[model samples]
Target: MPQDRIKTIGRSRIQYGPLSDRVYLMQLAAGEAEAVITAMAELAQAEGYTKLFAKIPGKNAAVFEDAGFEIEAQIPDFYADGDKALFVSRFICKNRRRSCDAERIQKVLEAALKRAGAGIRHPLPSDWDLTFMTADRAEQMAALYSRVFDSYPFPIFDADYIRHSMDENFRYFGILQNATLIALASAERIESGVEMTDFATAPKHRRASLAAHLLAAMEADARQNGVKTAFTIARAVSYGINIMFARAGYTFGGTLVNNTNISGRVQSMNIWYKPLAPCPSNG
Candidate 1:
């Protein structure tokens, strides 16, 4: 198995790994502009990666392009606010020529994503026994996710993502009632603050405020870890989640137009951010 690399450039956070011939980049923060450029240049030099790819907010498209990345795809109305997203990539070495027309490919992919209506929600319950997942816990979490998101691709609830969470110093919590897994949430540090990911609750547990309880617990954990802000990318269609985050004092940061690819379709995502008492300096 190959190990993924994570680096903090200034306040920005980046994660990258080799997926075959291409280097797949995930979780690039907006604040780490110079750091990402320097780090990418170094990675290109050392790893001989042919291409580097990332998903970024539409507003930040020009920054990546200026850094040598080209738009390979764009998804419209893919976020909760119906904003657009650009999928970008660049050849590490100038000598490596790309074969496909990036603009054209992006148009095709965006059309397909528009047809798929997968959406997300957030700021869920914080109650129950929430902790890192064990093998048994993974199975239970998968089953709950499958039931909650029957139309979307279920996450590969293996120990690897869980271990990755641990490596990043993230707290992965699962809610259990009567020893049965009912909900889950994850919090990881980012350049801006802390981001909550992979929040889900089983259908049977919905409307019972399980998600709200879980979110409260997650927030408490984040505060303990020196995280002063909380954020999430939620589905625009998920009214319940949006409301929950609002009730918790999280303000609307912005939306990533088409940031999520689900069930072979594109959907819009909303960016919700909350200041956890004292905000962390982006210094």
Candidate 2:
């Protein structure tokens, strides 16, 4: 049986899952460290969870390790601001054995990474107008996204998605030409840094550097907001977008293969990172 728990710790909500003889934890914060750890151990014991697995920030990793969790994987700069993310797992009782599919997962991830390498471009454009997308501009932005990614996995032109993006983050930008949306980028802020989500340019406006302009705008917004770096997971098939990012000075950081299933195939994704300023610190 699988059960979930939502515990309020300070201003953050920590969500955890207990399944079979295993527990999975997520949405942890620094302030609630002690409580969360205690709750996890208690839950593991009560629910007969012999093992626990979680992804946590590097800063709070010591707490988990001290609690007997072993660092199973280290994803560098997995979160914003270049904070490394640690995957930790612990065995509760001596007699219990936990089975894992780590190797299969890793192989899928590696395939995705290989795909990312074939289609990316770093160091994007420098000069472009970037602005927040309002209700008035939502339709135009959607149209442009549709034109660029006609077969995107998610409905890019949805009004609800646009509103959610605006409400959740200040990292959304639109490239306008004569007051018409030609390109767009959306991002969300995380504890370690900013994650670039959707970036697209109208097909009719490609080659004219509309996507480049949009990225430049995103960079400006990142700087203004004290963001240290910007990162993204790009589809391995999008050659044009990758090329523009490369031209603008972004670097290939890492990749997550088959992390996302898109267009009926398990698409590979490339991770890219751009430092906002020289010698920037994520913390």
- Listed per model in order, the count of residue pairs whose N, CA or C atoms clash below 3 Å is 28, 18
lDDT per model, in order? 0.58, 0.61
lDDT (Cα, tens digit) per residue for candidate 2, span 1-283: 2234445656445444432344556467667766777777787778676666565788888888888887655556656656776657676765443223335434544444455423223333445445777766777777776665534434566766677667765456886666767778887776646767677766676677666666666677777777776777676556655556565666665443333334343344555666677334579
Residues 1-283 of candidate 1: C-alpha lDDT, one tens digit per residue: 2434555656555555442334445555657655676777677668766666665667778788888888755544333344555567676655444322345434433443343323223434444565656544556665665566533322334455555556655666777766888778777675436667777887777776666666777787777666656777666556566666666656554443333433233344556666566435579
C-alpha lDDT of candidate 2 relative to the true structure: 0.61
**Candidate number with greatest lDDT:** 2
Q: Could you tell me every candidate's TM-score relative to the true structure?
A: 0.56, 0.57
Judge candidate 2 at residue 146 and give its lDDT: 60
Q: Give the number of the best model, judged by TM-score.
A: 2
